[model samples]
Target: MILDALFFLIQAGLTLFFWAILIAAILSLLTGFGILDTRNRFVWALSDFFYRVTEPAMRPVRNRLPNFGNVDLSPLVVMLLVQACMLLVGAIRGYMIRGGLYF
Candidate 1:
């Protein structure tokens, strides 16, 4: 019972994390390449919000990574981490089920 609830919470968090990383990466690519202009107020606001929200996770990675020409790899790293977390949660759930620890 408790394990099922915990698994649900973890799954939800990981799903959101994956989506946030994906959106941030797409936004970063569009903005970086000028495909997405922040000229419009709505675009600017959305970009700003995403930047603020994702930067804390990305900045450290950005600092540590070497630039690959015009490409930014921090968001890729973030996405990978999110996927890894989801996989980890899945593995935990599997283990619990196999052991009959989750009801």
Candidate 2:
């Protein structure tokens, strides 16, 4: 029972992280296109929040990746990695449920 709850929490957190990376990417594009103005306090705060939430995960990936000039691929890469982690977590939970291992 506890393992199931733990797995659910892990999956939920990974899902949130996945969406954060996605939103940060979309916000960047909008700001770049002038559709979103950082001068507006609300827009700036939202952008800042997502940036803070996603940057730590993205920084190493950004550093290792070759520069794409104006385009950033780190968010996409990070989202993909987060998706993989979610899948792995589900698989592990299934395996454990099947009596494969115990935590």
State which candidate has the highest lDDT. 2
Q: Please, what are the lDDT tens digits per residue for candidate 2 over residues 36-84?
A: 9999999999999999999999999999999989989999899889989
Cα-based TM-score, every candidate = 0.83, 0.94
Candidate with best TM-score: 2
Name the weakest run of 10 consecutive residues (lDDT summed) in model 2. Answer: 94-103
Superposed model 2: Cα runs more than 4 Å off: 100-103
- On residues 1-103, what C-alpha lDDT tens digit does candidate 1 reach at each position? 7877888998997787678777877877888888888898988888888788888888999999997987888888888887888898899889988998878
Q: Model 1 off-target regions past 4 Å? A: none
Candidate 2 C-alpha RMSD relative to the actual structure: 1.4
Q: By summed lDDT, which 10 consecutive residues of candidate 1 come out lowest?
A: 13-22
What TM-score does prediction 2 earn?
0.94
